[model samples]
Target chain A: MKDTNDWKQICSEYLANVDAALVNATVEEKQQILNDITIHLNERYHELSDEEQTWEHYQQILTDLGPVEDYAELLNEKSPDKKKFQKHRKAFWILLCAGIGCVSVLACSIGFFSHSAIKKARESKRPVVVKTFPAALDRTVDPDTTEITVTFDQPMMNFSWSWVGGGEHFPETTGQPRYDKERTTCTLPVKLKPGHWYWVGINSEKFVYFQTAKHIPAKPYAILFATADKNGNPTEIPIDYIEETKRVNSK
Target chain B: MNFNNWKIQLRKGLLELVVLKLLSSGQFYGYEMVKTLKTIKGFSIREGNIYPILARLKTDKLVVIEQQVSPDGPVRNSYAITEAGRLMLEKMTAHWKDVIETIDTLTAGDTK
Candidate 1:
């Protein structure tokens, strides 16, 4: 029981691919081509019987239309605008490469003096753990706490991070790690169980993902905490959890 | 040359003529024209291939589009041949007949 919206979505997805392929066509030409194809598809869809108006039939119509790129090729074949666009694109790339060449030469000359400065800065700027959400070794964190955040002493590389330790003691991550706009703090979304102990290593010796923009690795730090039960009472650590931690640390 | 490639080239050349001929009968939307063309032997075409030809024909003033409202659905862009298109089709049809006659005469002995 697919609705008109579903049909429209399918057609839109196909048209988007076709639109991307019509790179050489002018904006007006692309619009005209897309409009014509949309009208064509709409007409064909309406012509179908109630029973034939299924997703399969809708897909078959596109199959009959053939590959989308072929339409781009056919439309671009005799277009005078395509020739003009190609010429402009060629000139644009030539100028872009020349500009990049000049910039590279300038960067190389400046880099001679900047290299030692950067090295000195890197040696002095090893990132430190400035703050943590659970305050490191707290014994009574809320089990319902959904995230753990760590702030750095300096702006770190936003794309790279490592919440290293594994096994049962490692918090179960619910989502990807994200960095604050300043790139100084990173948050890891996690799911914690009541009365369970958790420990996560930020950039261990083997996995040095936590690094500054200059590629200086952060000093290894550990986060350890135990969540309180529903009654707000501390519970004994499970034997299996301790065994798993030992097995993970041994590796 | 490959037979399929030969037919593809032949079909590409004949598409505008065939589309013009279809429009000469009556105003038809893009999809209707494609459906009608697909029924003819040796003229089977991908539905997408017709739009560029139609676009070219419209640009050349050989054919024009009229927006017509359908009772059951959205407004449809229907194509109809112009006076110029008819003149062009007439010449094309005549030339096509001459070519067919020449080919028939050339291959007459092969049929036997």
Candidate 2:
């Protein structure tokens, strides 16, 4: 039925010896030769019970078959010698292809990063003005309490201040610009005269243009608002705009 | 004479010829052929050794192999003699008879 431990050990040792001796035989021929021997052993072993199939009997059988080296010589005679070199070259090609695959992946990664860095550099060179507070045009507000705050998509550098039509009619005072930790939001503390309309603009051409911490330049953007009367609480109402802020383009 | 060595030499000369003649009657696998030949005293051979000779016969086109299901439900290699094998066996048999007859005549004259 099943091969005994001794039988299996004998067969394994014999096949290993045969394989070592068969240097010039193809792998397929070696396997077939081993299969034939194994089948012969199995057929003989099955003719007797496990108790009667001794290692001595198996040894005698192997001896009667003659030396395994002789068998290997016969197998080599039947197989071609050129296939050994082909198998060696085939292994080398697999290693070479694996190396090429790794290099291709590394090159693609470098290319992708270079493209991204170039794109980021181009975008950073152009300034963008995002939003302004008190976004009103010709509207009423309490100027004394109104604070102008601007939010940019990215952080900006602190710039010098200038206002048109605000010094004479409005309070002639300007406070330092306070920025958040991100520096994206800038608060301009200005004291204005009540019930007056003012057109305010900030840009590098007329005022001082700001650059980001990374040294990207910013352009001019404006807000228009009208102050509230003395008895009016402009903070109680939302600031409505008659004209929306327009896109800021490079000068 | 060392019995083992004598048997080895004897079988080496006549084994293939005898195997092909046995198969000329009907197909027989390695184990079956060994069992049949074991009936003759001093003709014993390891079943393992039969396969190589069978392979050689097949290479020489004297035998063809087939598979048959054994009673134990396992497939076994069955060897049958080809037309070429029968013709070769016939010639070998005639030559074997001549050699035996000549040897017998010489021995009989020596006894006289």
Candidate 3:
């Protein structure tokens, strides 16, 4: 006899895999598909005898249904692939715009520094540039906002940052450095917690003017802004950020 | 070209009509519809596969859903053909008869 655990595990895994495979299905379509599958599986299980309740029996039933991708394809075909196509088309345009924006930035930065202030700055060996938002150790920012952008004086060939210290490690950010048309600024969308200190190590290893070998690692930067409370007051701390004295550290 | 491909093509073309005709007689859930269709040769179907077709029919307002509490399990979503579905079936059936008659005339005495 199939134990409850076995049934639950198998059914859930199967459903999860099928759901993951159906990328083109709408929310309602996916829910309806899952509901239908659940009812059918339950009916099938009830019809099976203890002797017949084996992996092989279940495998046969699932196999008869064929790959879930086939169903997705069928659904897409019947529904007139227009929605999925529209989505892809929208994404393509966004990517195209971003690409054009980056190229423009690179060109303008090159033109700006060809013989201008950049050469003088290089000769003096001053901090190449100090530009970013939550501008250099800023102390107050709205917690509800999802991004912190960095702008550089000179166009950078490459730039990356990581959380060195914070309430938690940097949450996964979406998208790459989106440079403005001027190439002087790039916006990075980050997931930040309210009322938490975050330290990020900034690295700009290459620049349009400098070669890779001459490139020096920039100073480690930190964003010290406290996210505001629900009432928009910077004074209050969110419940999640309030460290409990008695809390045990699992690590 | 091939007989199997031709069969599938024919079924694909006739699916909506067949489904409407089936539902015309009575209401059926996704699984029940699959099972009932399976009784016919060359009409094999896997459980839950009828849902997308049913869903499309629902969207086109050709069918309506009625929820029923199952004695053995949770509520089952059953589908019944609407008047619109019946009208579609009648038109499709007449068109199908004409197509069949034309094909018969074109292939008369060709069968061995």
True-structure RMSD, every candidate: 19.6, 41.5, 24.6
lDDT of candidate 1 over B1-112, digit per residue (tens): 3455576678888988999999999998888888889899867788888987887677668988888887977777788999999999999999999999999998996888
Q: Taking the candidates one at a time, how many backbone clashes does each contain? A: 0, 3, 0
lDDT tens readout by residue for model 1, A98-161: 9988886888787754656777887677888878887666668999999999999998764457
Better of 1 and 2 by TM-score: 1
Candidate 3 on A144-229: residue-level lDDT in tens? 56666655545432222222332253433543334343434556667666665554434322212211113322333433345555
TM-score of each: 0.51, 0.44, 0.51
Task: Score candidate 3 by TM-score against the native.
Answer: 0.51
- Per-prediction DockQ: 0.21, 0.07, 0.13
lDDT score of residue B60 within candidate 2: 63
lDDT of 1 at A19: 69
Q: Which candidate number has the best lDDT?
A: 1
Relative to the real complex, the DockQ score for model 2 comes to 0.07
**Candidate 1 local lDDT, residue B111:** 88
For model 2, what is the alpha-carbon lDDT of residue A117?
69
iRMSD per prediction, in order:
10.8, 24.5, 11.4
